[model samples]
Target: MDKQTMLSDEELVKNFIAGNVTCIDVLIDRHKAKVFSYIMMCVKQQELAEDIFQEAFIRVIKTLKKGRYSDSGKFSSWVMRIAHNLIIDHYRKQKNQVMVSNDNYEFDLFNSARFSDKSVEEKLVHDQILSEVGMLVKMLPDNQREVVEMRHYKGLSFKEIAEETNVSINTALGRMRYALMNLRRMMEERNLSLTLS
Candidate 1:
């Protein structure tokens, strides 16, 4: 087995709990880059991926501080679970991303795979469609706009958003629902069916 596999996770946790915060640093150093890489795959933005990476660790520390997690299996799983949820939340919010100009559209701007697969004509047409949808999203109400921006751009959850905005999670969820409904109506009006995912 490798070095990490050789050390029992309990041993590491015990070290971390016994006032060796640097032991947790070792864990962070090992996992942070990989976790960010995974986030980038889903969120498709370097800055947003970095933000989510930091948030994931902050949540991890909170869980540890709460003394809620015992098994290392649960710890690792929990981290990935948080990352997964953040990515999903990001898509939901970005569904109606805004467009300030053609250059500000969100389509395949970050898709590395598309560059290799798409021709210039295809890319240009794709950018046009993205710009149109982004314009539609920009026309949504202010509260819905902010919620979507936080969800998509900042990768914050409904609960995290509620905490940030000093509102209830239900309010956050309601805003998201209305935002999606409005975006759908806008798309239908233009005969465009954009897939949020």
Candidate 2:
């Protein structure tokens, strides 16, 4: 488990399957940062991101123990798949309400060099678009909102989300349907059209 000893992903997987708990720790050390950052970027909430990070690794460990993964070099990809699923579950549980946690986040989705050179009027227009989108999300019904957030923010596949949320994949799809519809209605109410052409 020494940091100086770099192990290949396949080696780590083999050691982990052989009951070397230290291998799991080493794997976490190697991938935790990237996975955490990736989830954070998607979720935009620190507490939820942390929970999903822990859940992702826990699932990975369980899967390794189960000996279910069928290939190599795909360890990172598999872990990402777990992370995505957990995020969906997290939001599904929080659909109707907000979660209280100590983690805080500051994300600037609109701050970029592309915006830096824009005129003040253009910046205002960009800000308005972001504001409208935020408002639309806030107005979605509890269940629909959850589905949309999980799919868009967490990057979960419908099947993975269905597993995590304990719903049929069709149900997950229905919730997403309602979510988009409600968001569109809300936008239209505010004289903003968000239709995709």
Candidate 3:
């Protein structure tokens, strides 16, 4: 077995930053599939996914070369985040070209299945529900709304949310709990059915 193949991602990153160019290749080879798959899953387009995947690595290389990467032993997670952000930026740009009639902007919060896999009727229903839910989320209190957006829309973990919001994990979880309850209450009051008959 190659020694480089056995090195941890963090170790590979350190080696890469310390002038070992091949270490970056090993890191990319190890994580390319997972990172590319995530981008494909989110964007659902081959060309776009490839572009985002490349851009992610470019950003990763730039960050590492600039000594901006912290040694958190989470190099893969950090890479995935960069890819995710690129995907979000792509969608955000696309969204600006099209307008939806609603108080709140649309968000592709659900990551269950590929949108392209759905039938036309199913896709329409799914989009309607997503828009409705997005509006409901907009109506939540500021803190709860922030939590919901970060947790659901951004696909952030509770720990990440806590850190980003400068709160404890327990507090982040509590906000998510209350946000769900409030969304449920609002849905019930509006007699909204998320299901398609």
What tens digits encode model 2's per-residue C-alpha lDDT throughout 111-139?
56654566777677777777778778877
Q: What is the C-alpha RMSD of each candidate to the true structure, in Å?
A: 15.9, 16.9, 14.2
| TM-score preference between candidates 1 and 3, better one | 3
In model 2, the worst 10-residue window by lDDT is 98-107
91: Cα error in model 3, Å: 0.9
lDDT of candidate 3 over 1-197, digit per residue (tens): 28989998888888999999899999999999789878876876778888999999999999999999988758899999999999889989998985545446465544346533688999899999999999999999999999998776556679999999999999999999999999999999999998877
lDDT, residue 167, model 2: 93
Candidate 2 lDDT score at position 123: 70
Candidate numbers, best TM-score first, in rank order = 3, 2, 1
Poorest stretch of ten by lDDT in candidate 3: 107-116
C-alpha lDDT of residue 146 in model 2: 74
Model 1, 120-185: lDDT tens digits are 777777787788767876999988988887787556778989998888999999998999999989
TM for every model, in the order presented, reads 0.44, 0.47, 0.52
For each predicted model, how many residue pairs clash, with residues at least 3 apart or on different chains?
0, 0, 0
RMSD (Cα, Å) of model 1: 15.9
Off by over 4 Å in 3: 100-197
Output the better candidate (1/2) by TM-score.
2
For model 1, the superposed segments whose C-alpha errors exceed 4 Å read 1-6, 72-74, 96-197
Task: After superposing candidate 2 on the true structure, give the runs of residues whose Cα lies further than 4 Å from its correct spot.
Answer: 95-197
